[model samples]
Target: MDSKTQQTKWSQFLSLIVVFFFWGFVAASNDILIPVFKKWFVLSQVQSQLVAWAFYVAYFVGSVIFFIISLKSDILQKFGYKKTLAVGLVLSALGAFLFVPAASAASFWFFLAALFIVGLGFSVQQIVANPLAIKMGSPQTGAHRLTLAGGINSLGTTIGPILLGIVLFGMGNKEDSAPKDVNLTKIEIVQKEYQTHKDELAKNVLELRQDNQDDPAKVNEVIAIVEKNIADLDTQISSINQNPGANENQVEAYTTALGEIKQRSTNISYPIGFVKDHLKEVKMPFIVLGIAFILVAIFMLFSKIEDPAKEEEAEIEEGSAKFSIFKYPQLYLGMLAIFIYVGVEVSIISNLPALLHTKEFGGVLEHNIAPFVSLYWGSLMIGRWNGSINVFNMSKTTNMLMKFIVPFVAFAIIIFANELSGKDVSSFYIYAFWILAFIIMSFIGGKAAGKTLMIFGLAGVVMMILGLVYPDKEIAKYFFISGGLFCSIMWPSIFDLAIAGLGKNTGKASSFLVMMILGGGIIPLIQGWICDFDKTSPEGVMGITWTHFSYVIPIVCFVYLAFYGFVTPRILKKQGITMGETTAGGH
Candidate 1:
């Protein structure tokens, strides 16, 4: 077939990445939501993870719906990419609107349902966007092009948490402006929060003592925090019991701890700032996002974004592919790689709060740890920007120079976004070293997706291991945070390798790959359960070893990714696919 696809379609590619931005905005915002949801709902660690579970699982469900449609006729081919993306945006807008009611009711399930719908719409955008990213540029540079798109997506992840925090913590119902009434629900939210801190502190003190019985200074460090937090919890419980509307069980909760109070725990409305109750502020951001989504959809309707095969399809018989989609090992194995990649990516962020709250780590609350989470996602941007540099035609020296320059620019963007939102940027500057390390690694991976995946995957494994066993707690947390760096380019690597030989079936294969995003939901649940699954602690209590050591889960995930990286090239080579060569743009 005679070819018409350009070496690069910068205009169309630019339009496409706006959708990528929305995906990142919502996805990274979920990390912020998990802890907030837990705090609002009085949910245990495991239960709170349902926020991520419900959201990511929808990708699988949405993919299934579209995949079934493809069995009859191709949706992407029939509807075209712009129409499909517009439809996806409209669906996402509807989900975003649901949050208003979700907030009004303060129902956790309602919030989960809203997130699920948003992810449903994202599933469609992802199906269209990824392949389009590849097709918009030289096939040889497809993986790097996708990495460039992901860097744009990472920009969303970088700012999403900050803007979301502004909405969640700094918005409606100003703390000093409101008067206190007596609603037990507010009291319960406060009580659970204090209790959670107390429980985590207690477990940390225990772990510290066990780790070194001789280190009384270390034990005392945690002992003071544990005692203070428990005192706060006890005082909160007394206040709960003082309410006449409290249930029998609610009163007994305190009675078993200290003694009894005169009243039941009920009828206690709180001031806006009381225990940081910002539930009313949650919907404002989503409402804004919903409006934005509708506008984007309208733009898409008028937009000129074209399909991948649109220009080339005229030269070939439309339905004349001779191979089955299943016969490709790249597709099947790539499906598993996508699952593992999405799983590890999501699981790391979702469980990170638990790690931070560990007394050894700092006992920081979720809102306070936004800088860490922001930097983690920002690490992806730093790496992707370095990888994305490949999309341009440049000399090897120029490419090397861009790799050195671009990652820091992306880092500066993260710094500016977070600092502008009032987060301190002083500590975030040290993260530059990690970015430097990734830059060194990107040079090693070159432009080949398989080689890049293999190297980066092993790097992820090493980072996770350091997070697990590294002696310096401060540096160790950074090690764990570096998971985002290694992960930044894996999606393009796997996607590029998987669809190598499947010309027309790329969309179908992509649907299956997108469906495996179910990992993002399920893997987090597994890790979250592990966070709560302490045999040493009784039921309903937070665990000790699992918080820091739970990093082992990602270690396993990265090991498989590394394995896939090693074996995939062999498989692709057997099929006469050489993915490791320096791609079209000189590297």
Candidate 2:
């Protein structure tokens, strides 16, 4: 390439990286939002997860629309990359500002509306960015460029969670004031009655002992008399015996007392009900976030993109036969791979914090320790950094090998480190595993083939299953976190491979690809539903645990990605393009 062309390509590359960073920060921030919304709204595990669902579902819906448009004529040919991206940015900013009202209203649906808008903005950004990046470089180095972009994106993701955590969850406020209509009066009345009864029982026991101290038989007689009197009083109090023609206040008091007794009895009958009820309140934020994500889809109609190449192609096609890009088998497979890969990624990050805190699996670290958990995200950033640094100098086979070996070794070390530390693994070891996995995946990913890198996703699934099967051990718990290292490169790598060729059709293809992100939204909701189901079921029956449900997500992700690894690149090749060569705007 000439110096001017090289510079143009370089400029585009930098711009796409900026785009990735923005979306990465936004996407990963959802992790922090999940727990925060859960707390703020008092939602259940299932409901709180809609934050992911709302955001990702827009990708699916938006991309499908873009894909359809591409079938008519490339949308970029009509609009252009710059205009399209600007619209996306404006929509994103609008979505961010929407949070102001959502937070104030504390209405769950409002928050979801904001999140849906944000997701719509992301659909545009993603659809434009991936193919554009591929266009800027050679096919072989496409993965490397995307990897670099992924690293920057990871950095944004790392910072997003930390920043949002501080803003939302770290405010040192624990008292969640109840809404106006929830009627806490009943609870307060019950509490007061229980306290009064407790005090009376103590006083009666002390008096009975004192009254019969001189003779053992007298002591027994006094005790029996006091117990009978207390029992009679308790029966009257529980029954709330109201005389005929009582005043309104007295009637209310009597009914309140009876209701309290019934509630107490129910609590005794079902111990987990209270916890489940509270969990339901925790999911309100996620619902709001989901709605917000979908609302932004409307912005796409007004958005436009700039592409000089697309304009040139349009002129040539003025009298030619209309071509449909959707007929390409390679593109279909690529879209599926992206959908599955992102789904796995979202599920893993969403669940990692909870998994690390489980006492049954030796997650002794408290939620207060954000630094330890940060390592999981930090590793992805580090791996991306290494990929960027060496993108130009590495061979394909070498890159593939490095990617595979790093994650494998990282998981192995995590297992060994946990076992060696015994019951009390220092928090430092937890941090070390994070650092080690990042280094390994980064180095290996910098040299491995895109296909080989995708295979590591399977390793993550296997580790999650191990964690579920042996929930009694700390090592099993560590495996789930370790899966992060293996998962680190899968998204960028698979993405670069999928849109390998489509030339001017790259923009539409990118949109189609971004739509696959709906996997992230849907899969987690499924997992959350499963978790709620398990929590509600009988202990020893068909009930599945949260950890077990987590295993299913990655297993499905890897199984699909592995198929893509072997077949997707070839399909793209058959379509007359290599796995990393297609360019629309930048990817």
Q: lDDT tens digits, residues 68-172, model 2?
A: 777687766567766666667667666766776666556667778888887887787777666566556465555556666766677666565545444443332
Model 2: residue 78 alpha-carbon error in angstroms: 4.7
The residue-by-residue lDDT of candidate 1 on 248-347, one tens digit each, is 6764454333211111111112222221334668878999999999998888778776677755544333533554656998888888999999999989
Cα RMSD of predicted structure 1: 11.7
TM-score of each: 0.78, 0.64
Number of the top candidate by lDDT?
Answer: 1
**Deviation of model 2 at 311, angstroms:** 4.6
Off by over 4 Å in 1: 1-12, 133-145, 171-277, 306-326, 534-544, 580-587
TM-score of 2: 0.64
Sliding window of 10 residues with minimal summed lDDT for model 2: 172-181
Deviation in angstroms for 524 in model 1?
0.8
Candidate 2 Cα lDDT to native: 0.55
